[model samples]
Target: MCSGGFAKCLGITLIPLAVVCVLCNILLFFPGGKVVESDHITDEVWYSGGIFGSGVLMIFPALVFLGLKNNDCCGCCGNESCGRRFAMLSSILFATVGLVGAGYSVIVSAVAIDHGPKCLALEDGKSVWTYPFNTNGYLTDSTMWSKCTEPVGVVSWHLALFSVILIMGLIQIALCAVQVINGLLGALCGDCCGCCGGVSMFSYALDS
Candidate 1:
């Protein structure tokens, strides 16, 4: 496939993934479907990894990739091949931006998953909202989830949504990494199929 077309596909795939990440992060604020004070929320949610890092930052690169195909003759002294190559070259920068954003989301989501959820739990014979599971072993022990007395299954909720963000962030990272390589190939070779056509036409002219 031509690099431009392939990038367009990558761009389309990123949009929905980014949307999912944003939604997951937003839902993290209201653990177990119950709204809580801003201060009571888990600390990782405030990092905005899914919302700002993967979500918003990814939009720019996606858009740039989508527009690459249309740039076949956009600039560069009216040479369609040069114009396409230039567009592909520029996409490398946007891919780098995507890489940074997705990497940030991945790191934050992983940390949040390890830390567990913040909710009301019994401590010292009193009920207070806090990070009930400080150890990573909570993921394997369902009984430990009972520690969060309030928010109605907050442990599960936190784990599910943050897990989604983590997975999606990893996907975004992979796609952006592919784009980096694709962009380089496109810049160096122009559109693959289009180059074949150009070669054919040049040979035909020589034969004539």
Candidate 2:
């Protein structure tokens, strides 16, 4: 497949993933699917990692990738093949942006998972909204989840949403990584599959 075609596929795949990440992050604000005071929300939800990092930031690259497949420059100053190559080259920069954004989401989500949920928990015989798990091992210990007294099943809820963000972020990272190489290949070698009169256009672009 032409680099542009592959990029288009990646772009299509990224859109839904980005949307899911955004929704999951938003849901994190309301722990256990119930409305809570702003102060009660987990600190990590405020980071906007999924909303900005994985969602908004990813949209740029996805759109660019989608447009690349139809990039035509018949009336433009440059050769069409050359223009296509340049567009592909430019996509690499956007892909890098995607990489950074997804990486940020992954990091934030992972940290949030490790820290567990902030909920009303017993502290000195008083219930206060706070992170109950001080140790990493709490994730595996279902009995320990009872520490969060106010938001019932909050530990599981927190784990599910953040885990989705983490997985989606990793997928975005992989897709962007693929696009980096694909973009480089597209830049170095004109998109042969999409070129009409094949070798001539590819050769002409290289010769110019």
Q: How many residue pairs clash in each candidate?
A: 0, 0
Which segments of candidate 1 are over 4 A away from where they belong? Answer: 193-208
Estimate the TM-score of every prediction.
Answer: 0.91, 0.91
lDDT of 1 by residue, 52-166 (tens): 8899999999999998988865668988889999899999999999999999999999999999988989988999888878799999999999999889988899999999999
lDDT of each: 0.91, 0.90
Measured with C-alpha atoms, the lDDT of residue 129 in candidate 1 is: 81
How does candidate 1 score on lDDT? 0.91
Error of 2 at 151 (Å): 0.9
